[model samples]
Target: VLFPGVSIDECEAFTLAFRQLSLSGLADCQVVGVGAVRGEVVGIGGRRDVEQTFAETTRPDVVLVPGGIGVDRTAHDEALLSWLRHVEPSCQWMAASSTGTVVVAAAGLLADRPAATHWLAGAKLAEFGSAASPERIVEVGHVVTCHGRISAMDVALLMILRLTNRQIAEQVRIDLERAHEQAAVARPSWWKRAVALVRPAPRGPVRPRNEQLDTSDWVEMELTAEPSSTTPNGDF
Candidate 1:
């Protein structure tokens, strides 16, 4: 929910990526936020929707709690904690960014889960049995956490992965030019751009095979093909 000192950058990244669901092929997906009360303008200029109070908002399949200096106060808010516990059963996954982990951990959904939060609060999270990590993003089962606002973009992408498929997730990467971010991690053989199809992606629409094909195109294609007898050890 919107509150004083909410990480404006993180919220913006998350909200924008979520809204791209339609372009990513999840037209039905939704991403919205609420506040402790309706019509409240949070610190640094964030406003919750009209009449969108936490108590009035329906249970959500996914929840994202952002963090900032003010989140320190929320971490110890019993009333909010109680409300989160009350709605816990209905959540498909729960997430937090920056110091927001402190608040979400207070709700009891993070037991035995690995999580990450702003480096400044990394040690503080240890008290909650979260097995905190220094990584930018941590995921275990239905819980996701991001270290700080710097990782907000990656966090948003992870959220998309949870809500959709890899193809759609890859699309977001392309749109955001983040494919290199996952370069060190294992991915499908077909995922690397170096081996992408001869046809280009969205920036240049894929051309129809027959649009310029001539009878000799078949012979030209065969000339570029690897011989069927090519060996496993690079022998041709």
Candidate 2:
């Protein structure tokens, strides 16, 4: 994964999904985060440490470029663009998410192809000669583009399906979802707990009537009822 001004949410989505695949024994894979330098790269949500610098990084089967506020500056980086151009031929799959599509497009990798990006960046993506798509995941040849940060998990699952099989992918998805649900139940947010405490208990189920009333009896009773003068309306 390329960490140039990365969106931590997107990064985590991809990494966590891939990690689940590995942890579930569905696939054997290693996800490495790379950057221009060796240490930590401050990103949108948080900072992440890169395992390798661009120079030390080996050829990866898959390359992921994540988008963030730093993309404006990273998009203009000739070194990163040059590096991406160099890696394209060797990479089996290339992916970008959100504004990262702009960086890939800037690298001249998305030319004349349809690519997915954040809705707001469609016009910007078109500036690089690629047709921008609103689809959550767009697969054109070996390149995959995700529309937004949340779509990162979709891309990861797609990769798993492609690399492994539908069965494994489905298993991974179920496992991740189960884990997420368990986590939510295990440690709910303060607001959720507060709401639960103040919430009224559910009402008991209604008891069945011992005897059913006839519709004719109800109509007769309504017609025979006396009107109350205390109601202020003489007609009742």
Candidate 3:
């Protein structure tokens, strides 16, 4: 994994997303940093998962780069560029999240390739010899790219689905959806909800399958938020 000053969201997303693969027992592999120290990675508030893992002589089958201000800085790094160019031939797959595309594109690997990147980087793709994609995730053979940090979640889940099956991805969707629900509040989608004869939900990813607070749980959660906001209709 490329973690050259990656966004904390990107890094943590990559890390927490492993719960599904690990839970489903699909990814029979581990994570390692290309140029990271063993104890502390100095990016995105810092991560401890990517330690001195280059102990074996084996090369990674896949490489994923997450984006941030660090990626912008690394885009001009001759050392990183040279390494990417050298390793690409031996890699079975490669991908980037958000501005990490800038770094990968800097290595010349994306030349003439169709890929998606952080929207802010749309103008920069032409500079790197790659085509911009209309989709959030784009794949041309073994090389893939995701548009942004949140979409990076899709990248990881999609990889799990490809390497394993749909069941695992569904399970991951459940976990991720639950996490997001716990983290924020959102608006409902009245149109889609009306189609199903259900109430609208939020603007983000759909709630996990088989999930929705029961009447009692809903009331409890509602009271926890703002006791006075709770009404007979459960409107808040």
Candidate 4:
């Protein structure tokens, strides 16, 4: 875990849930955070506290990044990026959720690689030199990226499979009551489907809201500002 102080929620969720699963004998691994603080603090407990006191270390077997709105803070942080660059060599497996790929991309780690991210931030990944796709989960080389919250279960299952084997993945899936909903469709000619793993859905607009104007629509705010054109008297 690369715990950026800015990514408290993502780090906390991934760490706690991962520890629980690991402790339950789902997987054999240990969780460590890089760039954490020194002692404990309340409110932001466990992983948050761990990350707060995280000491920098070389990469391990796998590195995972969880998804949250906080990814923007991690993606642009230079110190965190520097750490990732330094540890890239020792790391073998890498994973990220949601816009967390933004940080991976910003680190220049996704060049010429396929990655997954929230649809809203896919274009941003492209701008950072990654070939972003609508896939719910994408894995290219040692890097894995997924739509985080929306595809957490799928990503976790996939990681379990890769880390252990299909037997573990199947058993965990049964425990979690998740059926593998993955399928392969013909890739579009124009779009390279190298690592695209989309969560196909019925094509159409979903959950159309027949919203009439609500009372809140009548509320508006007026702002006091200078006029578009300056008055000759400077007071009009």
Candidate 3 per-residue C-alpha lDDT over 29-144 given as tens digits, one digit per residue, 9 for 90 to 100: 55565553345555665553455434331456667777776555678877667667766787766778778887888888888876788777876777888867877778777777
Tens digits of per-residue lDDT for model 2 on 80-188? 8887898888877788988889989989998888788888787777777887785667888888897764567777666666565556666777787788667545765
Candidate 4, residues 1-236, lDDT tens digits: the string is 44433344445434443453465576666776545454433321233444432234664666776654555666777876776676676776677876778888888988867687777887778778886777666778777787655354455555555555554545554443331122123334434333234544466534442121111111111011222343221100
Q: What is the full ranking by TM-score, best candidate first?
A: 2, 1, 3, 4
Off by over 4 Å in 2: 2-4, 187-236
Native-to-model Cα distance after best TM-score fit, residue 39 in candidate 4, in Å: 5.8
- Where is model 3 more than 4 Å wrong at Cα? 2-4, 36-39, 45-50, 53-58, 70-72, 175-236
Q: What TM-score goes with each of the models?
A: 0.66, 0.75, 0.65, 0.60
What stretches of model 1 exceed 4 Å from their correct place? 23-25, 44-51, 176-236
Model 1: lDDT of residue 90: 82
Model 2 residue 43 CA deviation (Å) reads 1.0
* Residue-level error in angstroms, candidate 4, position 74: 2.3
By lDDT, the better pick of 2 and 4 is 2
TM-score computed on alpha carbons, candidate 3: 0.65
Better of 2 and 3 by lDDT: 2
Error of 4 at 160 (Å): 1.6
Q: By TM-score, is 2 or 4 better?
A: 2
